[model samples]
Target chain A: MPRGQPPLSLPALIYEPKVRGIIFQVLLLAALVVAAWSLASNVAVNLQRQNIASGFGFLDRTAGFEISQQLIDFKPTDNYGRAFVVGLLNTLLVAGLGIVFATILGFTVGVARLSSNWIVSRLALAFVEVVRNMPPLLTLFLVYFAAIKTLPGPRQSIELPLSSFLNVRGLYMPKPQWLDGSSTIVVAFIAGIIASMLLARWARQRQVATGQQVPIFWPSLGLVLGLPLLAFMIAGQPVAFEYPALKGFNFSGGMVVQPEFIALLFGLTVYTAAFIAEIVRAGISGVPKGQKEAAAALGLSAGQSMRLVVLPQAMRIVIPPLTNQFLNLTKNSSLAVAIGYPDLVSVFAGTVLNNTNQAIECILITMGVYLVLSIVTSIGMNMFNARMALVER
Target chain B: MDAGIRNRRIAITTAALLAVAAGPAMAQTKTLDTVKARGTLNCGVNTGLAGFSMPDDKGQWTGLDVDLCRAVAAAVFKDATKVKYVPLTAKERFTALQSGEVDMLSRNTTWTMSRDTSAGLSFVGVNYFDGQGFMVKKSLGLKSAKELDGATICVQTGTTTELNVTDFFRANKLNYKPVVFEKLDETVAAYNSGRCDAFTSDHSQLYSERLKSPKPDDNVVLPDVISKEPLGPAVRQGDSGWGNVVRWAHFAMVNAEELGVTSKTVDEMQASANPEIRRLLGKEGDFGKGMGLDNDWAYQIVKQVGNYGEAFDRNVGAGSRLNIARGQNALWTKGGLQYGMPIR
Candidate 1:
C-alpha cells in the first residue's frame, strides 16, 4: 500500500515460490543433519562408555574358522577380509547358476501352458501353482530334507549316463582336466569364432547386394567347430577327462557338486521359475492376436509366425518383469543358510559374527555387499531393457 | 493480519504441549523404589533346555536354572510363587536384560570376558561348570575326537560354542568344516540327517539333545573336553545393587548346600544350635539387609528351591537321564571347583 518506489524488496523476493521452496528444503536438510549428528554422538558416547571398539580394523584379524563351501582357496588362517570375498563369490555363483536354470524352466513351462493339448497346459499350470504357493524356506527344507537326503550314500551311488554318480554325498561327474597346450587350443577356438562371425556378415551383405543366397550356416558351424577340433589335434589333444570313481568309502578324482549346492539351487530355481512363468505368460498374452493372423496371411506357418512376428515383441514386454524375478532369485540365495550352505550371509555374517563377536561390523559389511550387488544387477538389466525397447522413427 | 498472528501463537502453544506429552516416562530414577514396593520379581529364562531350563508337561518350569531364578524371587519376596518367568533365546537374552524386560537372566549363559566387558552385562556367579565337546554317531566308530579329522561339524550360530569348536580344532592342528545353523534344533536335525559328521556344543547340551533324539543310544559323545564353559546368571551392567543381589542369591544356595542344609530340613536347621546355621538361616542377624531383602530371605530361598546340590541332582545329576556325575560342579570342600562365599 506504500507509495514508495520500493516496498520491501527482500521480503517480496523471499515470498516467491522458488525462494520459499529452497528455504523450506534447506531448513528440512539442516534439521535432518542435526538429528543425525545427535544420534551419532549418542551412539559414540554409549560405545565409549562400554569400551567397545568401533572401526574397520578388525577386518585384518584372522578369521579362525573354516567355510563349508568355497569357490576360491581359503583357510582358517586367512584374514576376515579374504573370507568375505570368498563368501561373496559363492553367493554370486549360486545366483548366476540359479538364473540360468530358472530361465530355461520358466520359458519352457510358459510355452507349455499355451500348448494346444489340455494335459500339457494343465500340468504347467499346476507346477506354477504348487511352487509359488509355498514359502521359499519350506521349499528349501523339502529339497534338502526329502529329496537330497533320501539319496543313497557313496557305496550305493546311483550310476547315471556319461559316468556320473548321484548320491547323498554329492553328484560326482567327470571333470575336464586341461592338459599342457590347452591354452593354445582355447585361443584358436576363440579365433575361429571371430572368423566365422566375420564370414557370416560378409555372406549376408553379399546376399543382400547380389540377390543370390549363400549357404553360410553350415560353413560357419564347421569353421567354429572343426577349427577347434583341428587345433586340439595339432596340440596333441590337450584335454583329458577325470572320471569320478568310488574309492574305499567315498568318491574321488572328480568334481563333486555338494548336496548343499544342489538343494539351494533346486529351491531357488523352482521358486523363481514359478513367478517367471507367470510373467512370461502375461507377456505372451500381451502380444496381440492380430500380429499372428497377419503373419499367417503373409503365408507364414504357425511356428514361423510366432518366431518372426510375435516373440520379438513379446520379449520386449517380458524382459522388464523377468529382470525383477532375477533380482529376487539373487536375494533369495541367502536362504541357503537354512540348509547349511556357506552363502555370504551364512559364512561371513552369521558365523563370522559369532566367532569375532563383531555383530555390527559383520552385518553392515554383508548388507553392503548385497546392496552393491542389487544395484549392479538393476543397472545392468536396465541397460539391457533399454537396448531391447522399441525405437520409434 | 493480527488475527493470523494470534492463530500462529496458539499453534506454537499446542506444539509445545504435544512435545511435553510425547516426552519419555522420566521414571528411571525411581526403578529401585518401584521394585522394592512390588512383591514379585520378573526373571528371564531359557525357553527349553531339558536339564537347564524347560517347562514340564504341567507347564511348570522345573530345571536347575529355573530353580535358581525361583530362589532369587523367594529370597526377595519370601514366596516362590512371586516369580514370573520370561522365556528368551540366545539372541534376545541380552537385549531383554538391557531393556529391563526382566530383572535378571538365569539362563545357562557362559560368562566370557568379552561379554562381561563389551556386552553391557554383568555375570552374577558361575552356577554350573561345563565344557565344549563333540558327539558322533556310534556307527562311525569314532573312539576319540581326534579321529574326526576333516569332518563336517554341525554347530549353532550366535553362541560361543562355534568359536570354541573352531579354536579347539585349530589348536589340535585338525581340519574341520563347520555346518552352522541359526537354531540348535536345526543343527541337531542336520547332524541326525547325516548332513554333518559330528555335532559340537556344550557337553550338557549334548546330553540333553541325546535324550531328545529318537534313538539316544545310537549316538555317543566323545570323552575329550575341549574348552572350559562356566555357565551362570547375568544382569545388566551399571546396576551393581541388582547384580549383588543375584550373586548372593546363588551364593546362598551353594553355601546352604555346603552346610548340610536342604529345602526339607531348613526349618530344623534354623532351630539348630550352630552359629553358622543361625546366621545363614537369618535367625540371628541382618545379613539380608545388605542385599536389600528381608532378614528371613536366605531361609525362604533355601526352603523354596532347595540347596544347589539338590537342584542339580533333580535336573542333570547322577539320577537324571543325563546321568552326569558331580565332577567339577561339586563343592570345593569335596575337591571340586564350586566354592561359595560364607553366608556370614
Candidate 2:
C-alpha cells in the first residue's frame, strides 16, 4: 500500500491560490524580523564595546559651535536643538528658492526645446544634454572651485548693478534698512493682496453673468505695485538703503552672502533644472496635437491656444514628476557638506555628530527630518494634484 | 506529536538568537591581532598637513605625525616601513579610528576632553604641544591678535581650531567673521585669495601653511597663542594592550631623547654603564615584554624612527623649512611638557 503512494510535489504548494500568498508573505515577514533583530543586537553589543553612547540626549547639550547663517537668534552658546533648527531652516530656504528658480528655468527650456527656431531648440538641447549627464557632486565642485574661485578678491571686488559687489568672500548687496513707521506700509501691502483677490472673484462672476472679460493681469499688477508705492510715499518712504561700501577688509554696512551658499544653490538649480526640463517636455508632448488644433479652430492665437488648452493638460502630467524633482533637489542639498554650506546634513549630522560622538542618535534625527520633509512635500503635492485632476461633468 | 515538532522549532530559534547575541565577540578581531595578521600597520594620517604629516615631492609620506606612525610600526614589526598610511581629513579622523579603519591614528588631531570621553578614543601621549595663533598680512599694520578686530578669519571646518578662534575672538570682545572651508588646502587657498584678512590654526600649522602663500614673508603669525592644542597619536579605547604598545612607543622616543640615545648612538648606548640608558636601550629588564612586545622593541623604534628631538628638528623644527621652535615640546628635563615614565 505505501509503495503505491504518489511522490511528493514541492512546486504544487505555490500553485494553491489562497495558501500561496500567505506562505510567501509569512516567510518575508519572518525574514525581515529576524534580520532586524540580529542587526539591532549586533549594533547594541558593538556600541557598548566601543563605548559610544546611544540616545537623543545629546541634542539637549550646548552645541558650542558657531553657525554662520540663522533665521532666528542664535549664538555659539545655544543648544544643539537650536543649531539643528538653524540648519533645517537653511535647508528649507535653499530648497524653496531652488524649486522656484528651477521650475521657471525648466519650463522655459522645455518649451524652447520645441521652439520653431532651430537655434533655440538646439541650444536648449545642448544645455540639457551637457548638464543632465554630469554628477551633482561634480557640478558642485565646478561651481565652487572653478566658477566662484574666479571671482575677484575682497580688495578688488567687482561692482555690480543695484549697489552690489561680487568677491571671493561672497556677493554683497545693499541692506534694506526698515526705518520707524514701516509697519503701515507692510499693512497696506497686505491690503493690496486681499483687494486683488476679491476683484478677481468679482470679475469672474461678472464674466459668467455678462460674458464681458475684464482686463485683469495688468490691473492686478498695478494694484499690488501701486498700493505699496502709495503707502511708502504716504509714510514718507520709511525704508532707507544701506549700500555696501568697501571698509576695512570687507563691505561693512551691507549683508555678505557666503560663496558656499551661493555655489550650492547654483549647483542644485543647474542639476535639478535638467531633470525638470525633461519632465516638462514629456508632459507637454503627452498632450494630444488635436487639442492645440481645437483651440486654434476656436479662433485663438498661437500663444492663446497653448495657454488655454495645451498647458492646462500638460500641467496635469507635469506636476507629479515635478514634485519628484523638488524632493530630489531637497535631498541633494545635503551635498552642501562637500562645499561647507551648513545645510541640515552638514551642520546637524556632521559637525554635531563630530562634537557629540553620538552617531546613532544624530543619524536617526537627520533621517527623521528628511523623512518628514519628503512626506510633507508629497502630501502638499498630492493635494494640488487632486485639485487639478479630472472631474466628471 | 505536535509538541515534538514545536520543541525542535524552539531549539532552532534559540540557537539562532544566541549566535547573533555572540556576534560582537565573534565578528571583530582586536586591532593588535588584525595588524599582526595583516603584517602592515594601518596608520590614519592627514592627507597633506605640511609639517605635521604631508607627502614629499617623491610621494613618500614624511612629517612629524608620519614619524610617529613609523615609530609605532618599528616597535611592533621592527621595520619602520611596514605601515600603510591612510590619509584622512579632519572630520574623518575620529570616525576612522572609531570604526577600526586604522590600527593607530597619527593625525595632527588635538586631544580634547570631549574626544576622549565621547568619541571612544584614547590619546597615547602628546607629541606636539601647540597653541592656536593667527597669520595676518604685514601690510595690514596689525601687530597683535587683539588688534584684529572686525577681521575676517579663514579656518578649516570640523577642527577644534575653528572653535578656538571663535572663543578667542569672542573673549576679546572683537567682532570677527569666520569663513570655513572643508580642507586645509582649501582654507589656505581662500586665505591666499584674500577672502579673509587672517588665517588661524595651531601655531605650527600657521608656519607651515604660510609657506604655501605666494609671499610667505608677508604674513606673520601673531604673538598671541589663543588656545592650548596638545596634538597626539590616538588609538581606539577598547583594547588596552594595543594602547599600551602605542603609548610606550611614543614614550620610548621621548626617554631616548632624554637618555641621550640618538638613532646613530643607540646601538653603542646599549653597552653604556649608565643604568637609565641601559634599561632604555633594552640592556636590562623585560619592559617591552610587559607590554606584549619584544625585549628590544624600544631599540627598534629608536634605531628606525629616531628619538623625539631628532624627529622634531628633522620634520618640523629648526632643521626643516617650518623652522618651528621646540618651545613646549622639549623633554621635561629641559623644562617642557613631555616626560616619559621610568622603564623599570
Give me the TM-scores of chain B across the candidates.
0.90, 0.91
Q: In model 2, what lDDT does residue A80 have? A: 91
**Which residues of candidate 2, in runs, are more than 4 Å off?**
A1-38, A41-45, A146-148, A153-155, A159-164, A177-181, A205-210, A240-246, A390-393, B1-22, B26-29
Fraction of the reference Cα-Cα interface contacts (below 8 Å) that each candidate reproduces: 0.31, 0.38
Error of 1 at B264 (Å): 1.7
**Interface RMSD, every prediction, one decimal place:** 12.1, 11.4
Can you tell me the CAPRI class of model 2? acceptable
> TM-score of each candidate?
0.88, 0.90
All candidates: DockQ: 0.22, 0.25
Give the number of the best model, judged by DockQ: 2
Q: Write model 1 residue lDDT over A40-119, tens digit each, in one string.
A: 66555544443444567878988877777778988878988888888899899999999999999998898788989999
- CA RMSD per model (angstroms): 7.8, 7.9
Instruction: Write the residue-wise lDDT of candidate 2 on A186-297 in tens digits.
Output: 8888888888898899999999999998988888888788898898999999999998888776777887788888989989998999888899899889999999888889
Under the 3 Å rule for N, CA and C atoms, how many clashes does model 2 have?
0
